[model samples]
Each structure stands twice: as C-alpha cells, then as structure tokens.
Target: CQELPLIPEQDSRDIEVVCNLYESLLTLQRQGINGIWARIIKNAFAPLFNKEFDYVAGNPPWVNWESLPENYRQDTKPLWQEHGLFPHGGMDTILGKGKKDISMLMTYVAMDKYLKKGGKLGFLITQSVFKTAGAGQGFRRFRLGSGEHIQVQHVDDMVELQPFEGASNRTSVV
Candidate 1:
C-alpha cells in the first residue's frame, strides 16, 4: 500500500485546488470526522467579499433551513430576506424544507456583491435554480449588466449518493 500525500502538503496555490480541498474536508466532516478547516475558513471569510474568484467549484450542501445549525440559520436570515426566499415564521416547512436552497441564494449574493462586472462564476447548483418559480423568476430578472443577465453553461444530470441519493433528481452543474 502506498500513502497518499495530504492536501495541505501539496504546494500548488491554485484557488480551485484550495476549494476542492475544502470541499473534501467538508464531506469528511459531515461523515463524522473532526475536519474543521473548511468551516473555519468559510466563517473567517464569510464577511469578507472578494472581487472575483478564478475558479469556484463544489456540490454545495443542500441542507434545508430546518436542518441548518442555529448559528448559521440566524446569520443567513438577512440574506434570505434580501433575496425574497424567507418563509413565514422564519422557519422551513416540510415541503419548503431544503427547497429554499440556500446554496443558490448564496451564489447569487456572492455574484451580486463580490464578482466584478463581467467576471465569471462557475459553480454546481441544483436544477431547481433554473426551474423553481421563485428562483427562475429571480434569475430571469437578474441583471449582470445594464441590460444583461447571468447565463448558464454546460449542464449535467445527477449523481447517486446516500441519505437522499436521488433526492436531487434534477441536479445539474451550472
């Protein structure tokens, strides 16, 4: 058996590489490991907005509002309100649970507040972003330029996973 080098031990400074490492760590943590690096970085940088990222990639956690941790749920309320995704009672309903898709909302927030005009954003998002009434309307109404809006590129179907493998029946890379 051969030993695989740890990600942090690698020398490349590519942001995509860093984000990939973060995603892997996050996946491991969700599986019950003590991986805390990604959460730490996200928390530290959540408040700091960057002009743009050269490369962004990940299968964002699809946790619904009801499943979100208290702190994050509280912190993200304003974003939900600003984006018009907040439900009544400030809580998620069974049908609405996970349906709000904070990942998509966060992506919009990042692009609106951080990405430079004409800058590109590459991320994996649920197909609902393209089909959901609210999200679809929002995307259609989104303005990237004076009279322009965001566009979608190469799309792919869902991959199988546990705990809800096919729950994302319409998953796509957008």
Candidate 2:
C-alpha cells in the first residue's frame, strides 16, 4: 500500500475526497466524528491507499527535493536513495545536477506496479521536462532504460500557453 502522508499541496483534495465522498463530515457535524467513521473513511478511500493499474494517468505530485517539506523529505529519503534519484538528498538542488521530483519517480515506479509489458502510460506533466535537462533526467532515464517495452506514443506540448491559471510553469501531455 502506498503510505502517502497528507503533504501540504494535497490536503484540500484529500480532505474533500475522504470526508465528502461518504458524507462522513456531514455525519460528524451532526453527531460528532467517531472511530467508526474514521475507519470507514480510510476504507472508503482504499483505491487511493493502494494502486495498481495498466494505464496509469493523471498528474502526480510535483514537489521537488528543495520544495518538499522536511518531514516528507525524511519519509521518502530511503525510497529515493534506493531508486538512485536522491543520493544523500543534498546534491539534488545543485545546478546541472540531477534533482528528485515526485512526478519523475511516479513516471517509472508506477510502471513497476501499475504498468508492465504491453501496458501504456500517460501523464500531464510540467514542461520542466523540456526546459531543463537535469530537472527531468530521471524521467528521461526511465524511458530510455525501458527499451522496446515502452515506446513514445505522443507528446502534447502545452507550453504554447499555460494550462493552469496563475501557474507560470507550462504543462504537457505525455
């Protein structure tokens, strides 16, 4: 199971999905939340807790090493280390050096579980993949190493205009 701690960016969506989906928060408002609701809510979002798919999609978290919270950094250090994404977790932010981004990790790691031979994958990702060689090296490496098992189907360059309002960084569909 993916033990995703409620990081800063996902709190709103996580809370909404957890509480609103089953009206558990509504029940809490009238009767006060109880252990049963908590358990039910956790079970209610089982799909979020556990993931395995043939065609994984959607935007994963974009937090890079420098922007990540200290607690999250601590929690994912071992995983990053094992993947060779964040060696020592210190040199990641240096210029021209490969840095760790959650989205980069998800691109391939998801393949290990959700995608396998003959499976396809896609994501709406940041344009950092094109703008910076180092920022997107992990993702590049994943595709490169996948050999003939993975092939580039399409890449929608959304950089002509920003997709997210107020987001300076452009996005892409790949």
Candidate 1 lowest-lDDT run of ten: 1-10
Candidate 1 Cα misplacement greater than 4 A, ranges: 1-39, 43-49, 87-98, 134-140, 143-169
C-alpha local distance difference test of each model: 0.58, 0.62
- Stretches off by above 4 angstroms in model 2 are 1-17, 20-51, 87-93, 143-150
Q: Residues 47-77, candidate 2: write the lDDT tens digits.
A: 6648565677878767676676566567656
- Which residue pairs collide in model 1, if any? none
TM-scores of the candidates in the order shown: 0.54, 0.60
Question: Compared with the true structure, what per-residue lDDT tens digits does model 1 show for residues 69-146?
Answer: 666677767766665454333243434433566666666676666666666676666677667654344443554323
Q: What is the TM-score (0 to 1) of candidate 1?
A: 0.54
Best by lDDT: 2
Each prediction's RMSD to truth = 7.0, 9.7
**The candidate that achieves the highest TM-score relative to the unseen native structure:** 2
lDDT of 1: 0.58
